[model samples]
Target: MIAKWIKFQILDTERQDWTRGYDTARRYFDREGSLDVPYEHIENAYPLGRWLSDQRRAFRAGTMSSTRADELEELGMVWDTADTAFAENLAAARAYYAQAGTLAAPRHATALDKPVGQWLTNLRRPNGLGKDPERTARRAEQLAAIDPDWNPGQLGWTVDWQRHYTGLTALLEAGGTLDGITPGVTYRGDDIGRWLARQARDWTRPNPEQQRRLGKVGVKPAARPQKTAARTNTKARAAKGSDAFTRGVTALAQYIQREKKTVVGRHHVEELPDGTSVRLGVFLSNQKSRRDRLTEQQLAALAELGYHWTQ
Candidate 1:
């Protein structure tokens, strides 16, 4: 099921060209098994079909030359006959190319406008084939010297292969081995893996909010209670009030002109006997550190004092 899913994923992914699709499909089939899975289970079948149809439309739109159209047509025919096996499909495509009488034709031009033929010919050298290890080392050493922090795994292997192949010719033209051979450094897979692991850790490490969410999911950390700024400020204010309660109360009374009205709570305003209005909250007290209820006498006294008593 996983293999089938992966196959569908590969098929659905947008490749640069048919050649890239062929290469990727080959790799997938080699890693996974033959793609004989049910087509109905592939969610992107219609999308893939649409993409192929678009390619065919582009081919027929006179954008491609007659020769290019022929090549594309041959490729299409191979695909039509190909089974789910990517290697088999690639082989069939190659066979079609070989038989088309234009197998060696250049597909595109490079930055220098050099034909693909020239590029391919220049870059088709076998890996690890040089006489001197020091000479072979020069290319790798140069790459490392230029980028000390380059991850070998993540670095474009395709570009590196081209460089390694083409650089040999360049190195030879510049006067051979003794020109300047830096010692070759072979980076361990483990070191690159560790660097990748560190990168993954750095990228995915949670901020405080994410950590809290993770904690809710049963991931334990230091178990310290998160102290918010508002909570801290409130506690500090409460502590300050408790420490200087009498002075604070006195100051408040002074601020209100010292004419105490009928006592209620901290937020209630009432009229005083001196014709100056004062809040009834000035003499309010907390009973048992909980809400205090007003007695009938107290209520009557407040009402008689022209204070609006809200139930």
Candidate 2:
């Protein structure tokens, strides 16, 4: 019994867990040309990926032997995959900004074969950069360096609005005139004339900063001519009401995207891209109270905003 016990101990010592894991990792590295294994990857029924993750955790905790860490490092092991991913995404963002002249891409947009627009949208969300405050600030600064207006939410504007504004800025700089930019005219596929008209029509809605920007670009509030003023009042009122509803829907959509929730606070005010603030909480409350009064089109619009109500 003593001799058999001694033989078992000798066999166990010859097959240490770390030694076996290292051998599998080395074989994987040789075959895949990389050590960036997925967490659930298995090789020859051995959990090579989990084993590598264990090694990384040990290294981070200062429990790994220097020899073992060095061996894994030699095989191109990525110590911090998050940092590596950020670097790659940043590169893609840079490429997008270079071509678009603005980083205000649609959520479905792509660049450099990367989903850079969605990445940017995610990063713009609260705590999107990271949980570490200092690290988040540093990363935000890096993105700011690429495009100071990358996150236009703080500027009280949507990405779509920013994109159109960028095109307008470029056009004006190149000697385009407001008069020549009629309704059918476009800039970078955006109807600049229609956008400009909206800005003028809703001139009182825009905040001071927006007003100043528009003023600098020679845009002013649309003047109401006295000749047909009485005749246009009713028509104007109907049009303005429609516009207000559209703005409210826009504000609600943006709120849902940023907050990732539909339950807005009672006093929650959503700022539209045109700088108008919608009292979303009150708006919703009023809408729900008069749910039966909503027209078919209005009901569909609210449903599209994910505000499905039983009536």
Candidate 3:
């Protein structure tokens, strides 16, 4: 199955070169974002082709190494050498290259393209490229001297010490097990503690659903009624309206009486055995709106209140 997942491919070097040339030619066709001159014409007119041909000839003739050495000498480097200084420099260069390769390509390329002497100079400075054995030893000594009673794993100690000594907050933030410290765990500092406290506050605070549940559980206080126009006044106004308005009001009333039955509306009235009828208006008013359905608890409460069906 894994073998089926993998596929092999090969690059056509000649085709690649041809495609590159084609792209370069296309760039000249639309000179909005690039150079305006036609590269193909320039290649044909200038000694570019001849130069490339000569380079290929030299490569095939095994004269490329000698040519490269002469070019290096022109840059002020003594290529022909077997001395200790030469050997040491070569070793340092190789080590530097290895270290640079571990970095991102852009940074690596920048370091690699720097002058050899300049790069070597950078490696010797206090905050330089080369590793300092003496500094490493001194750090170890300082760590040992850092109040033997001060546990490195303690919350404030590591952060405070690292800040005072190295100012490497990034390294401290990217937590890991240091010497005498537990792995996959971080010390809780003031910031972390505050974060945890805020999270606790958020968790303890009631959400909408939780508030509704708490209301149901009789733990929360009853919600205050919204200030609304009296239903009696509304009904009185509807009754005194024009013919069209009266018809609309009648139709709405009929819709509420008929269609409201399909849903568990509070309009469902009940009569008691003592010949007393309870107005569903009270239950309806207690709800969000008369259109809202009654819960089982509300229904049971209505029943306990001596309510019976009354059409």
Using TM-score, give the best candidate's number: 2
Per-candidate TM equals 0.14, 0.53, 0.14
Global Cα RMSD, each model: 31.0, 12.6, 31.8
Global local distance difference test of model 1: 0.35
User: In model 1, which regions exceed 4 Å deviation?
Assistant: 1-15, 22-47, 66-68, 76-311
CA lDDT, every prediction? Answer: 0.35, 0.75, 0.33
Per-residue lDDT for 299 in model 1? 30
lDDT by residue (tens digit), candidate 1, 100-173: 22212222422222343333222223222134566445434433343332221222122222223233333444
lDDT of 2 by residue, 1-311 (tens): 98888777875664487788888888988988988665546788988767777776787789877887788888888788475567667877888888778888767778768999889877866567899988788788888998998876666545665777777777788899988766767876778888788778767656666678888888889986566667688978868877877787788889988988879999999987777799999888887888665543565566545554511
On TM-score, the stronger of 1 and 2 is: 2
Compare candidates 2 and 3 on TM-score and give the better one: 2
TM-score of 3: 0.14
Q: What is the lDDT of candidate 2?
A: 0.75
Count of residue pairs whose backbone atoms collide, per candidate: 2, 0, 2
